[model samples]
Target: MTTITVSPGDLPLQCLYRWEKERGPQVYLTQPTGGGAVLDITWAQAAQQVRCMAGWLQSQGWPQGSRVAIIGKNSAHWILADLAIVMAGYVSVPIYPTFNAEALAYILAHSEAKALFVGKMDDTANIKNGVPSGLPLVALPLAPALAALQWADLVKNNAPLSGQPVADGDQTSTIIYTSGTTGKPKGVVHTFNTMAWGVSSATHRVRMDVNDRYISYLPLAHVAERMLVEQASLRYGGRIFFAESLDTFLMDLQRARPTIFFSVPRLWVKFQQGIHGKIPAPKLKRLLGLPLIGNLVRKKILKGLGLDQCRIAAGGAAPMPADVLQWYRNLGLDLIEVYGMTENSGVSHSTLPGSRQTGSVGLPYTGVESRVDVETGEIQMRCPALMKAYYREEAQTAEAFTTDGWLRTGDKGQIDAQGFLSITGRVKDIFKTSKGKYVAPAPIEDRLVLHPDIEACAVTGANLAQPLALVMLSPDAVARSQSSEGRQTLSTSLQLHLQAVNAMLEPHEKLDCLAAVTTAWTPENGFVTPTLKVKRNKVEEVYAPHFASWLAQGRPVVWADAS
Candidate 1:
């Protein structure tokens, strides 16, 4: 699996010096901090911390295309300051340590980011008050700032050098931002020849390999987990691990036993409500429609979510919930679902490996090129890793391309006739309903978040007069309201699962109401946005004044009678 000709003088962090001159430590990454200490990172300590953090950012006079940024959470020095901000040629942006500080003071003063690398979390000592008091930072010892300079204090007495060696089709190498879910978040750039022609146009559109491992928890500051962790793990030389918190993500997915596990559909509806909170959806569909107890209850629920040696388990950003993709295809985990947008660098479509659909979003994407503007079915697309704009804004990158260019993905879709697609929502999450009927609340909160007592839901209404969902339950349904007979049996089983999800919605997107809040719209409550989504305009401005007496008393409504 070696092919070259990648050129802005050849880099993508020299694919960790072609895997340390071809496989050396036999392990690339496996972080599970101290108590379980294992840092691993090799390919010669990740090409000697990408040449001592690109030779101390070229002895700090910060020049070349200069931009830097790199916020926090998800580490290995958040991929060593994203490969020393592209081997110090510079320009990396990233921010999303759950943004706020006014969206990192507008992307650290709109990517004029001279430097910053913050990652360690609990908000890296308030990221230098969200950077811009003459921006320049270097903290990084997994960021709980013990007087900064950490990456072992900038390579204690630095050396292991290298100067220029960057090209794999170079253009700008990394920028990623957009999870602003309609408002601030913008900057979406890329280049190492548009991410090595999007990692060989997605390994020739999904026939991926190089013994693919991918288990790096999402928010590599996004763009489908930085094109599956920094350009398909440097164009598929794979193996990356990370996750060990969310209470030991299934024992760090059975100690990094990954083959390809990327998540999103709100963590695949909390792994199908953690397998219907331990079986019982008609006995987990009679043990997955038997015939060998359906591959041994889909190999014991993918070996209890260590994802039984994954082998491709995708789901990306949002829209996916065809009953959680037919309960991960009745547990055989071909979970698939993918559609893209970091302003088109992640993908243009997917859902292929053994044709999948469960309410589409798959197809196209081999050097992508799509359409659907059959008058606002929106979608458009074009990709060559799209972005090359939007960073410095230029009128929202000239209204996100077109006039013979494509890329307008403000999400609303169609496409069919075999080129899949589906989507049908997010033209600013659609609204209207005093009877002008046009509710589209993500297919009724993807069918009331496959009720295992939902863990997140947000279907607000625009000019009001209908659609309402809000929900945030599940901490095992608010730890069953710490008993008074488990809060009258979780308010009579969430009012009989919101009366069986409003008798399967449609009377003007029924769900006419349902409050239930306790606060799990996480990213430390700005009502979610660090890839866990929800900031539906800050949960309609922190629950629109406690949803005004339950929308002037119409139906459902209950966060203890709307507060």
Candidate 2:
């Protein structure tokens, strides 16, 4: 067996040059058009377009290392634009497509981007308001009609860039803004060497090759998707696929039949709920207990989910519920938990493929060092791929690291005897009740989401008698609650669930009641981040005024109208 090795100093462009010479005819990207139409771009074709775009970028004659912004959902053109930015000796600033007008404007103005590349987006109104006046705008192939330069026109007009241009390893490659939950988003700057080092070192833990395939559905603006899907594909010469839209996600997954799949915990829970919708849990459990029928049922479920061919499946960005993790394991899928953050270039700890430990996020990746602060119980880490600084914010950057240089992850955790790391909670997420006892919401919320009726939850009580849990029900549960009997049934089940969760907690940490929120928690509503993380501060702001009143009249379960 042979393996591809990359040094810490290797650049992404160098890998592209290698693939262009070795696998030029092989398809590198598969993009879905509406109505099931598709476009397959070979390495040779991608290289030519990237080169031409690079030439056009150079023609603008922006100073080297000037910031260039990209805003769009995940697509082949998104990746190509990023590569072109790098090839043109510019810094790429990727803004999440779901960002509202304010966030979009902040990043663009703050980065001082010389130009912007607009790609596939569900809403163009945000872009219209967010883009500053007189800034250059280039539209990708899938972009909606906009008053901007066309990508096809530029490629057709400019010749391919002469020679294989490479960026210096130490030059800035990108500035990834954190999907902040508390305050304004901060820009995390990473150099070419740091970004390349992260992707290169990750291969040692999860192997990939030219034959590997992936579906790039997660936002490429996120560090996880950028490193795992885009950069990893460039390094290993793998084929990358794009999901057309949310409506066609399943069809896109089936088309890709990806060999490597990565997803967050919320999506994983939704997948489980979808499976249970088709096959009830009790009957499915009974079938899985049988001898040969169990294997067949497992395969059928995996096939239906479009993950039958997945050799490596992992979850990150948040903790995986214990029951959900075990349920996928029972289906013969090794769904390991990966733990990392944007500041670390998305490199930290990950569970090995076949060596999973319950309730732990595995061991740290090779070349990574981790420790838990004795006083604060915070998890601190040092790795070669850590970011250079928080862009332009000296105070925040200084606060993000210790004097000795370990990145402060802001997460509290424990390291087991076997070296497995189990996250206890976020340091900033802990709240105190009126009695002055602090409660860690993460561990308790993990237990709350295990109920099939609940989709998401937040446990919060500041200076109150007892902490209470505010929960958003799953879509099926919400629909079922429309009827009188159905509402009563859901109320009783939630009461029981509240009792079960309380029985496991200490007196001060126990919840007062379970409040069912009638409104949805979504990114648009500012209830959750783009990555689906609950915004604790937002939850507190909207529900705090009614907390005392609800606690006074509350039984084991109560209802709150967010709207």
- List lDDT for all candidates, in order: 0.73, 0.90
Candidate 1 accuracy as TM-score: 0.34
* Candidate 2, poorest ten consecutive residues by summed lDDT: 1-10
Report the C-alpha lDDT of model 1 over 68-176, residue by residue, as the tens digit. 8887778766886787777767888887776767778777777777878777677443565656675667777557754456667676656756644674454677677
- Give per-model TM-scores: 0.34, 0.97
Error of 2 at 426 (Å): 0.4
Cα lDDT tens digits, model 2, 1-563, are 12334464367888888888899999999998788999999999999999999999999989999999999988898999999999999999999988999999999999999999999988799999998899999999899999999999999999999789997788899999998898999999998888787886677889999889999999899999999999899988999999998889998998898999999898998888888888999999999999999999999999988899999999999878888888998998888889989999899999888854678888888788899999999999998899999999999999999999999999999998888899999999988888989999999999999888888999998898889999999878888888889988999999999999999999998999999986889887899988889999999899888887788886888888632
Judged by whole-model lDDT over C-alpha atoms, candidate 2 comes out at 0.90
- RMSD in angstroms, all models? 22.2, 2.1
CA lDDT for candidate 1: 0.73
Error of 2 at 220 (Å): 0.6
What range of 10 consecutive residues in model 1 has the weakest lDDT sum? 1-10
lDDT of 1 at 437: 81
